[model samples]
Target: MNISTYRQLIPSPVALVTGANKGIGFEISRILAESGIFVWMAGRDSARIKEATASLKKAGLPVDAISLDVTDPQSVESAAQHVQTVSGALDILVNNAGIVNERRLNKAGEPEVIPPSQIELNTLRQTYETNVFGVFTVTKAFLSLLRKSPAGRIVNMSSGLGSLTQRSDPNWAYSVVNALAYCSSKTAVNGITVAFAKELKDTPIKVNAADPGYCATDLNGHSGPRTPTQGAEIAVRLATLPEDGPTCGYFDENGPVPW
Candidate 1:
């Protein structure tokens, strides 16, 4: 059935998740749909997104696909337009697309540490293109739709590595795995979350950041101990938060995360 027909049946809240073709993003999309929200699973690859949506459809979930490349302004605008034309309003938005380029693998195939001082400027720029700028672009594009909702929510996927407090602690477990580009980009995401939350404080819309706690995904070469489904729990919770839920905050599964 078409999106309109599906909406007619469920008529529930609507959500859009970026980079939802696989890994943590896919799990987030799955969880949101399972919760009765009509999900727009977006990704850079058209084929991948189609496949991802298909899997959800087979499971009898309310979902559709959107081809979105977070780094491209035109693509983002087009996606916003499509949503406007179809859903008219969006209730939740999860910015889950991100990348890591400064990491490498040794002969043992384990993650090799790259010192922050040695990270290339270009690598940082590339990382920000998807992780930082993409969040800004997609959020700006969808803010209008979100405002139309009675209670809008924004969930930005972040990482514990982005925490300045945790990173500064010499005893931090992952301190030795310093990846400047990836970690700093997530830090910027938290800042963006706070900025938007403050700006819309009086509105019904709530904005928050989620730390997935190093899930095993392609971004980290599948090295994390946590499963993608486990990582998606916090983001799904943030996206479906109640009107009285906290905003402008960073949280993990347990609770608040250090900034």
Candidate 2:
């Protein structure tokens, strides 16, 4: 369909998706745009952002390239300002930018796993900088614009690896795959999601975290069985949630995930 035809689907809702230059973030942006939402596809790289945006536009999706580095405060501020100037209000904010430790595993299939004791502090810090702290930075920057909407939604791209419940289970498939840095960073994101939800309880804004369920993306070297399009389902659900939808919770494709 052409861009004009795509525009006639759902009532337009403005959305900003961070780390959307590729992978699950890009898939989520495509889905949102397919549903008639105008999406700002935000990423740190100018070249990648341009390429991704051009691809989406060619596909007749409503998407704009946005230079957003979640780890950089000034960049986040600039993105928020530009959105406000152009879109006036933001109906949804999807915090999807994050990183995983490369030292342990990749597509080549690693032989040795890096244990918690062996993991470097710098690696952990870098993971948190993008996964945990980045969410806080982006959310804070666009909160005002979100508040302007009749019903605002914040979707934090989280993972089941963060669940202490799953990690403690002996039979779970991913139980043995724990990488301390990435796991702990996601746990922190869940905390941040709940905290913001509580603080905004009385308002129309809803904040929730989504577990993409092991998608085959660059983060995992395409080893995961599920595709990015499949992984984006839960996030898209939460992003366009009804007025009565639950908030301050972590969810997967099936239902609520244990914190």
Candidate 3:
């Protein structure tokens, strides 16, 4: 924390977090910026992205709103190109954009038949398109910039519901919270994180999957246990890992979660 050490580090280290217009992503942007990082608030909606950046700016945070639609290849490439020109290197990448459709009802305790059979295929696909595929596209687009950094960090925003160990165990807390599309998509995100981590095993990047736990956000109708502030803690921690930090792992705020 000394002046010399701080000066040796990258001034205003750049961070890109997708789906940051609101909820957990927004909180992550705020927290990172507050910690002296230049945050790139990425989202699909133009106005929301501006609003997110404006709100953070009002708080005296250094944040830039960027249009990033994870599922759209053209949009991802364009955004990546812009970031390359401006920052030249991406120090941290938080893939926090995710979606769920099992809202408006107490489906958390519902039977398996209800969530899978009752929900439409289109709904399932739409959820995956946002939660899973979006993360892949965004990560792929920014991997090079991240590699250029001395201490690169990639925090894949995953969930506890994605844990197969929890799902298989009948006594586990997340076992009853059944939603095929949503949970499975997170599982895919975890797998993708592992794959990328393996590829960059010898590099300086510290890639890990972080579960924000249950947060009160629009995705779940704001009925979750924690607030967005509480949820952003782990995402920021994983994003700021040192050169010797662990990689290809899954963790919440307190510690690692069961995979």
Candidate number with the higher lDDT (1 or 3) = 1
Q: Which stretches of candidate 2 lie over 4 Å from their true place?
A: 1-10, 105-112
**Model 1: per-residue lDDT, tens digit, 178-235?**
7888888999999999999999999989999999887888887788999999999899
Provide the clashing-pair count of each candidate structure: 0, 0, 0
User: TM-scores, in order shown?
Assistant: 0.94, 0.93, 0.92
Which regions in candidate 1 have their CA more than 4 angstroms from the true location? Answer: 1-11, 107-110
lDDT of 2 by residue, 1-259 (tens): 1233323322567999999999999999999998779999999998999899999899899999999998899999999999999999998899999898735554687744578898888998899999999999999999999999887889999999989999889998899886899888999999999999999999989999999999999887788999999999889888888776899999999999998
Clashes of 3: 0
Report how far residue 91 has shifted in candidate 1, in Å: 0.2
- lDDT by residue (95-125, candidate 3, tens digit) is 9998887544355763232357677888788
Query: Which candidate would rank higher by TM-score, 1 or 3?
Result: 1
Q: Model 1, residue 14: what's the lDDT?
A: 89
What TM-score, to 2 decimals, does candidate 2 have? Answer: 0.93
- Determine which window of 10 residues in candidate 2 has minimal summed lDDT: 1-10
